[model samples]
Target: MGLSALFRRKPHERAGFELYGKAVAAARDPWFFGPLGVPDSLDGRFDLVGLHVALLIRRLRKDPDRRGAALAQAVFDAMFADMDINLREMGVSDLSVGKRVRAMWEAFHGRAQAYEAAIEAGDAAALAAALQRNVWRAEGDATPEARLLAGQAMRVAAALAEQPFAALLRGEARFPVPEVPADAA
Candidate 1:
């Protein structure tokens, strides 16, 4: 996909070319399109996050050498700890915020383990196929994480740079996190 397409903002999350009111500070940077995104505005940004997180989770699962693992962990660190603390300034409840963080952590660990296992077994085709399914640039347009996992794999850990206020509360995470991919043992 073209760079413009990859960087295209979600309409529901944006008020025209601008972001969804800048309700979220993290939404303003490239990282928001990172792992799950440092979500600033809660508009379509919420949807972008799930796709990104799922892709990240899948990538981690296939990493036998733990590539980009620390950064993934760090994304959670900021959300569950740092970012969560910061958003408290905005009047969001701690419990609600905590649930969101926990859900994201679950998705990340679950998908990561599954995808990493696939790669370790020399299943490039399977890995690619799995990634293709997660690609946001497809039929309906991509979300934050999907765009991130599209091609390159580095610059991923810091991808989240920070998690938004509601990464796990929507989309794929809302759907039901598979402990392992259906075809896996």
Candidate 2:
């Protein structure tokens, strides 16, 4: 094998990386920060990324074929791979990278389950509560913006649902642009 061949990703992994990139971009949308009250901090960004990734995984799992499940796993691995690189770039010691990545994986797992359950149940209140806790780090009650964000998430899920599985398999995902709620703005 050529030396460069070692660095090449499998087709599915390449698609997974592309899909994860789209999710990250969607999560970083300024509308989320301005109107939805998603914090622009690291924790906020992580939570948003986790939420988007979870949504994609949920959709992938719906396919009756094995490709969906495989792609979902690849996407998850791609995310943690990125996370490892990010931690190193941020000057985190190599010794701590494993621990940090593990912690992040746990956090992502918990949030994904909560988001999946709420969205699948079509329970906006539960989704809002989960978002409020993770995105806003709030307690007691969900804020109006949290509720609005939950609505936007539902819209995102519906939009994703409308997309063809073939498109997703080809590493393309489309997210609807979020609108500022009248009251939120």
Candidate 3:
């Protein structure tokens, strides 16, 4: 590769940034903060964004080809890049930014594993438990809000599954509108 190529983003990397943007937008949906009562603080926002990014990564990693792996890494890179920028903008000193980003990366991976496992098992209760612990910062039995969010996660997974891998590779993602569970409503 030429020296110029080193500075320029590959096409897949560009698509990763685009996909990350879409996930952030989805994370910002008002339903989560309003009805679901996710905290509006930085930590809350980070968890929400992490959730969306993790879901996308789960889908991408399902591809049997190297393209899937590359796109997943790109998306992961874009997420940490955004996190680093946000930390700096929040006035975290340059020295501590790396430490903070490392912590955030670890936190994201832990939650991603929990969510992925629960979703794969089709175990709503487990998913709700994980969401309660991560998003609501709660313990013991899952709360109503956590259950609702868990339901939303399952819906999102199914929706994402129906979307073509080609579409996601092209930098587009579709998330279902968050729904209130029937019993909750």
Candidate 4:
């Protein structure tokens, strides 16, 4: 490769990290844990981040431009790196961090596939069921908390669908806020 080519920053790498930051910020929104009833725990937070990342990835993959796909891969890499750092900071032993990260990756992949299929099918019920199984795994039934979270998921998906592919390529995606106000909770 030419020296210039080697030194040039990859657009996908820059956009991917920007988009990933947005996903993390959205996932950390307190409204999800408050009015949305997502459990305010480590597992709950991870699931929420995964949900946002999945939505972004789904959108990126659907773009006709090849760069979108590359950006998606970069974003996925960033997410896992963040997870690994989080595990280490939590005092997880180095010997077991790989196992935990792998398990987390597997869980993320499963959810992404289920969510992407549901969104592609345009089946609200399927999306809700997937959310119930993944996000609400601790809840035995389709409780109100699960329902609220499902609704939020649907809202995020729809908002993503409305975004222009070009805007996404520019790392300008936006998610809609839940209809209910956080203070109302």
For model 4, how does the per-residue alpha-carbon lDDT over 25-133 read when each residue is reduced to its tens digit? 8898887887677788999999999999999998888778887789889789889988999999999999999999999999999999988887788776677778888
Q: What Cα-based lDDT does every candidate model obtain?
A: 0.39, 0.89, 0.91, 0.82
Clashes of 2: 0
Q: What ranking emerges by TM-score with the best candidate at the front? A: 3, 2, 4, 1
Residue-by-residue lDDT tens digits, candidate 3, 1-185: 89998898765988899999989999999989987899999989999999989998998898776698899889999999999998999999999999999999999999999999999999999999999999988899998888888888888888887888889899999988887666666
**Best-fitting candidate, measured by lDDT?**
3
lDDT-sorted candidate list, best first: 3, 2, 4, 1
TM-score of each: 0.35, 0.93, 0.95, 0.85
Answer with 3 or 4, whichever has the higher TM-score: 3
Q: How many backbone clashes does candidate 4 have?
A: 0
lDDT of 1 by residue, 90-124 (tens): 77787788776666557545555544554446554
Rate residue 132 of model 1 by lDDT: 41
- lDDT of candidate 3 at residue 134, scale 0 to 100: 95
lDDT of 1: 0.39
Q: List the residue pairs that clash in candidate 3.
A: none
What is residue 128's positional error in candidate 2, in angstroms?
0.2
lDDT of 2 by residue, 131-151 (tens): 999888888688888888889
**What is candidate 2's local distance difference test score?**
0.89
Off by over 4 Å in 4: 1-11, 138-141, 181-185
